[model samples]
Target chain A: MTETVIQTRGLTKEFIRDEFHVVALDRVDIDIRKGEFVALMGPSGSGKSTLLHLIAAMDRPTDGEIRVLGQDLRGLSDREVSYWRNSHVGFIFQSFNLIPVLNAIENVELPLKLTTLTKKEQREHAATALKLVGLEERMRHLPRQLSGGQEQRVAIARAIVTDPDLILADEPTGNLDAASADEALNLLAKLNRDYGKTIVMVTHDPHAAGFATRVCHLEKGVLLESLQADGS
Target chain B: MMRISNFLPLVFKNSFRNRRRSILTVASLALSLCLLGLLMAMYEALFYGPDPTPAQAVRLVVRNKVSLAQPMPLSHEQKIRQVPGVEAVMLQQWFGGTYRDARDPNNFFARFAVQPQEVFSIFSEYSLPEAERQAFVRERTACVASRTLADKFGWKTGERITFVGDIFPVTVELKLAGIYDDPNQNEVLYFQWEYLRESLRPVFGGEMDMVSQFILKADSPESVPRISREVDEMFAVTPFQTKTESEQAFVLSFVSFLGNLKLFMLAIGGAVTFTILLVSANTLSMSVRERIREVGIMKTLGFTPGIILGTLLGEASLMSLTGGLIGCAFAWALCAMISSAPIPFAQLRGLALTPLITLICLSIAILIGLGSALLPALNASRRPILDSLGHSG
Candidate 1:
């Protein structure tokens, strides 16, 4: 039996702007299983990022509940949620949010600092993660010292350093050129395939979506349909 | 628990991100603290004795009851010595004069006339060579000068120096019989009372027996108050009544002429500290504002809010502590240099930076640093993750 990595039941999110009510996600029900690469696609303000944020436990739903790795996010305290995020999930941002002052390895080691791992173990894990992302040679370089694709690769290394079961990436290749975008997409695909890591990414690029095993389209706070990788 | 080793580098690097602003803030803080330290030293020098000698407690000064300007009769010295608790008495008269060839005409140094035989007995703190002490007592025109004063004027032991008196209308010359060294005393020229009295007799028509003040050494520190009371009461019936006080009180009374010196010092120090706090807090706020997104990223990476606050506070403390040390050391060096030089201000003659004062200033710097970071750290830690991440810079 494939374990459910994420489950969202009747999840709704609302925002109030200028005294007007805005519903970002309405009656959204979604599920992702272990080892599945799912892509969330939509136009601007269509609730794609909103749904991803809900699943990642970065934001709370107005109604219903979200369960990630069999743990209810709604029941967890803020501190527990932070600990859960550290142990179970990793994130890659659109802009490759790497700290400017830290080197590639130090940025990768950031998540590991929260764990009970010894300094040597953390260093080893960070080094291995950088190697997995093919950034071993650039491990000592700062973010400004790397190209766009290389910085994204470093961000990927940071995301995978703690060996998280779920990796949430929001437009990981949005700022990259075609070549760099392809490189980053290929890296993410490899992470899902070779490591059996479940990934849920939000992106507008069709090509980037094609790299995922399944693509879920959202429109006007509603999920339209999900397409399998085989187009079946 | 975040490891200190891991957190320190981040704090240090982030603090220097805006190099120009950080440097300017630190420089301003350093300059202010330095001025504060110097002012503290000045206050200590004025109200409390500059040199912390324990022997000063047993010493007493007998002055005219009305004011320092009023002189007392020389007969008071005999009556003061007859008191039961008085061990020794010396007549001291201020001789205000300018050296005949002084480079700066307005430059003033302490000059006094004292009884020759009582020099060593009264001021035992001054150490003079045995032969020089004997020679000073033998010659009527011989005088003794502090080593610092002798070095300043390039006067050898046998050299004769002339002074044109500003108060008394006379010119006098004396041979330098000895040079004494004492940390408690400043660079001064001391000549025989007989010489000053004889020089002034003809000008004043044989009525020059009055002296500025009398210094008395009590038999023991426990007897100082009793001796002071007895001496004051003895002169209560005379026309020239006397006011007797401990040496410390005498020095403090001189400082009182400036009016509430301690409060004045506290006001200046408080103003400087408050200004530094504001400047440091503003700088920290700006730095935190610029790094909102970075803070959000750290939070996403599983860093606790407490850790974020600690990191910011750590940066602030490091900056403040660095500035404080530099400022205090600078003030200490400046005070030392001024003390070694020929300054005419007697109150600041031996001004020094005591260890207690240095520690106080450094502690204040740390407090300032921590105090300045409180609001900024709290704001950064409590900011919503979504909002922080959404911030452009």
Candidate 2:
């Protein structure tokens, strides 16, 4: 039996803005098994990104519980959550959120600094991760020097450098051109298919969602449907 | 745990991301610290002389009880020498004069008529060759000039220099007997007391037996207060009552004539420090605000809040220290240049930065950095990762 990597039950999040309570997610339930590439699709006001944030433990749920890798996230302190997230989850953002001051190799090595790896081992792992993303020649290039596709690849290298169990991407290809978007999607597909790394992505584009094995739809902070992948 | 070395490059790069703003902030801090160091040196020089010596603690000066302008009778020197703990006594009279030079008519230097034999013994710090000391004693109309004074006026040994007296009603000529070197004394000329008294005797009969002040050396530092008290009490009822104080106190009283200069300097220094603190803090705050997204990226990469705070504080401290050192160096150079110039103020000599002053300047720089960055660092550290990541640019 494939083990469930992420489990959410009755999870809810509400944000208070200017004394007005607006619910972002309402009692959402989600389960993602090991090695499953799940795409969360929703419109502008949907809770797809909010759900991804909760699963990555970047935020706390207002009510109910979330378990990632079979450990209850609510029981952990803020510091423990941070350590657990570093070891268990890798996040990719729409803007390719690589630190501008650092080169590709240094950006990749950032996450591994939290691990017990020696400096040499960190360098070796970072180099290997960059090479995996087809950016071995561009390891010394800063983010501004790289193209949009190359920047996303470097972000991918940074995400996987720690060998995390799950990768969470929020609108990963939203800022890319069509060709670069296709290239970034192909890399995500390869990462999930070959390395068996579980992925949860939030996107509005059906072409981006076509790469995932399963698609979950959300509307008005409610999960409406789960659809099987139509082979791309 | 992240190694500090790993964070240093990022911290340094981030500090100068806004190069213009950072450069301006550093320049402002450096200039302020330079001014602060110079003011402190000036205050020190005014109250303590250029370079106070250990022997100054054991010496006392006796003057008129009413004011320094009034002269004391030269006969009181014998009575002061008789006081207990008095090791040596010398009579000194001020001679206000200017050399008869056409190029510089008002170039005035300190001229005093002191007892030739007792001057060297009383001011042990002054060093002169044996031959010159003998020459100064052998010739009744001979005078000794400081090396600085000799260089300024281009006087040589055996040369006769004439001074047109401004205070006394006599034109005096004397052979330059010797040039002496002392770190604390600057641009002074000393001649025999008898020459001045004899020259003025015919003009003001009997009244010429007055001296400006008397310098007494005690046998030990422990007996200075006792000797001062005994000297003052002995002349309490006399027409020319005396006020006795240590050499340091006498210099301090002279500086007191400037009226609260130390407090004024402290106020200016404080204002400068506070102004720089606000400027540096504002700069750091703006830097943090501009890098909100970058901070969030680091957070997502597993950097703890404490780590972020330390990185920001480290950047601030490094910037401040750099500015402070440059300012101190500039101030030290300025002092060296001033000391070599032909300045009439004796207090401006040896105004260079001391080790204590350097340390203080550096410490203030660090404090400015730390104090300025504290609130901004805390705000950056406490900011939620989601909020930071959500912030645009």
Candidate 3:
């Protein structure tokens, strides 16, 4: 066991839309040791995404403690949370979500900008990350010029360029074709197996969730089941 | 080093991507500079204009008490000399003239009758040799022509020029003597004052010694106002009154009649400055709108909002500064071309876009740039990460 990189206790998330209060997550306690591959599976609006956002420090939890590398996110300011997110966490979203203006290399180099690393060092890291994702040769191509899968690879490169310990992936293959989604899932699997990075991924697609070592099913703001032996 | 190096190409490409808009903006700045330059140049020409000053040292003009139109007694020439400021005395009448060749007379200009011997003494800036100046005094029919007037008639030194005098009700022909120009003086013309007096033999029974006006002088500008006041007081009790002022004040006083055109010029300058501000702001706003996604990405990457805002404002200032420099260069060229002109408000034209003026213009560009960029940058910087992250466009 490397360590317990992230720990959460009694987490709850509420969504209010048009004066309607909807409980997205209810008093859910989860613990995973470092180097864990945990998939959060649920249908749309099943609090999977909300739980991901809260744990990633992208949103403040209404109640309970969520800690990344032992830093409690409860009272952290926006800037503080942003700093923590930039340095400690990497994200792979369902959408490719790349800046159109920047090329693949520049997009990869984006998160590295937050580090105090030198420009040359940042570029080297970004290039290495793209190479790891097997897209080094496509560095200079803009998002428009790249395919959907390639853009997602670039996004993954950007997320990992900072070498963050925890990679939070939310429906990383939601926009990809089956072939491309297979490629993305394989990459994530390889990242978890080889690099020993802890990953907490949320997905509606069972095939996408198949890549994780364990899958947690959530229903109506409650954890329904935890299925282990899921290395599909 | 790469960060800085990369910024240049990126900024340059983006700034000029809308090529037509950028060029039109540059040209607009240039046109403003041109207009400003021409106005300043013409003003300089009319005031300390490039045309040489007329006889200032050796000769002086004696005028009546009340004004320029009145005549002064010829005997007063000796009395004027007795005054400490007066070195020599000459007589001149404004010879309002059309042209002898009215069929197609060239540009309109005026000529004056001058006391030749003392003309160069009183108008020391005039560059006539003492010999020619003396000859003009001795010869009753000799006249000194300005270059523009001489150029019109194809006249040369020692050649004769003729004019149909409107004031005297007769035709006047005078011998041309040594072309002249005075570096320190302004617009003027001169012929022998005695020639006019002698030429008037039929009208005043050779009593043309009664001079139309007199030119006064002092050793320095410091003495001018005092001597002017004293001279006026000397004729205070006489039937004729006197008015005296420095030549510059005399010339500038005429500017008042156009009814605060200087203020109008100031208003025009303000309007130009205001327009540049608006232009810069609009450009910045549009640029910000285009870069929303890029900004969002930057924020997610850990770039602080301050950095994003600074970068955008810096870009705006950079563009405006470049445009301002081109404008200043255009203004410099225009100023050089019209440094010498014959317009009435010469002081107001040929205005030098001095280093300070250039800085001011560029600074205005920068201020406008930053001012316009502030809001857009703020909007972009504070934009929620989610909105931009989710932005389809």
Candidate 4:
């Protein structure tokens, strides 16, 4: 039997702006099992990112339950949520947000700082993660010293350094050139296919969505359909 | 749940992220603290001089009742000597005169005509050889200067110096008999009272019989207050009324001539501190504002609000502490130079930057750092992660 990695039943999120209540996500239902590369497809402001945020425990839903890795996220305190998120989830951003001062290996080592790992062990784990992303040569380079694609690779190294159970990426390739974007998408696909890592990536690009095992479309705060990718 | 110690490297790196801004902020803090330290040192020296030694505690000064400018008749010294608890008595008259250059302030120091026979017995804190003391007492034209004063002017034994008197229309020449050392490094010169009395009598005749004040020592510390009262009462009905006080109180009264110095220094210090706080707050606010997205990134990586706030606060404290150390060192060096510059003000002769002053200044620097960063760090820590990530800065 396949285990469900993420389950959201009638999950809703609403934001209030200047005396008006705006609904970002309305009672959306989603189910993602282990080792599934699910791509959330939608236009801007379509709440696909909001669903990913809710599942990642980066935000709270207004009206339904969200459980990730069989743990009820709504029951966790802020501090508990932080520790749980650090241990269980890896997040990547579109802008390749690395701490400008730390080198590539140090950026990858940030997640392990919260653990009880010794400094040597943390460096060893970070170096391995960087090697996995093919950034072994750039371990001592700062973010500004790297190209956009190389910086994105460092971000990927940081995300997976903790050996998290699930990886969530929001517009991971939106700022990259075509060749860099393809390299990043190929990396995500390889992680899911070879390592059996569960990934939920948010993107408006259909070509990027094609790299996922399943595609779920969201429009106007509503989930339309979940379809398997043609290759899968 | 992160230990603050783990954040030190991050804190240190962030402080230098914008090197120019950090340096400017530290320089401003250092300058302000330097001024504050100097003012505090002066205040400490004036108000809290080292506690009186055992011999000093039993000594008293008798002056005119109304004002320091009023001269008391010489007969009061005999009556003061006869007091029950009085151990010894000496007369001292201030001779306000210039050395070589009357126009230059650096040529000024304390000069007094004192009873040379009683000088060593009355001021037991001073130390010199017995031969020098005997020469100073026997020769009416001889003068004794403290080692600090002698070093300032390069005067040696047998060197002749003349002073053109300012208060009395008379000029006197004297030979240097000895150089003595005192703990406070006071720049003072004392000459025989008979030299000044003879010089004055040729001009003002019998008016030269008057003297400025009398210094007396009691048999013990317990008898100081009683001796003061008895001496003052003995001269009450006479032509020369006397005001008697302990040696420490006498020095403090001279300091009072400058007005309330404590309040003055505190007011300036408070203003400077407030200005530095505002400057520091603004600089830290801009630094944190520029790093809003970075803070969000750290939060997504599992840094709690407490951790973020503590790290930023730590950065501020570390930067300000560096500035404080530099400022204290500057102030200490400046005070050393000033103390050796031959200033005539006795209150500032031995001004010093004590360890207690340095500790206090450093603590204030830390407090300033913490106070300046509180609002900005709190705001950054509590901001919603999504909003922070979305921030353009």
**Residue-wise lDDT of candidate 3 within B1-393, one digit each (tens)?**
125443443455456656787677666655665555444444444444333233322232345645566776766556555677654455556887656554553345557776677667666666776777777777777777656556655878878667887778767777787667644323456776666666788887756656666677666555666677777777788766656565555555556456675676667777776776677677668878877877766666666677677677777777777776777787777666544444434454435666666676667666766787899889988887666666654
* DockQ of all predictions against the true structure, Cα-based: 0.59, 0.57, 0.31, 0.57
> Deviation in angstroms for A209 in model 2?
0.8
The DockQ value obtained for model 1 is: 0.59
Q: Look at candidate 2 and give me any clashing residue pairs.
A: none
CA-based DockQ, model 3: 0.31
In terms of DockQ, the best-performing candidate is 1
In Å, residue A224's CA in model 2 sits off its true spot by 1.3
Model 4: how far residue A54 lies from native, Å: 1.0
Stretch of 10 with least lDDT, candidate 3 chain B = B52-61
> Sorted by TM-score, highest first, which candidate order results?
4, 1, 2, 3
Q: What is the TM-score of chain A in candidate 2?
A: 0.98
TM-score of 2: 0.92
Cα displacement (Å) at residue B234, model 2 = 3.6
Instruction: Pick out the ten consecutive residues of candidate 2 chain B with the lowest summed lDDT.
Output: B45-54
Candidate 4 at residue B260, lDDT? 84
TM-score of 1: 0.93
lDDT of each: 0.88, 0.88, 0.72, 0.89
Mark the regions of model 4 whose C-alpha exceeds 4 Å error after superposition: B1-5, B104-106, B128-131, B181-184, B230-241, B345-350
TM-score of chain B taken alone, every candidate:
0.90, 0.88, 0.78, 0.91
Local lDDT at A142 for model 4: 93
TM-score of chain B as predicted in candidate 2:
0.88
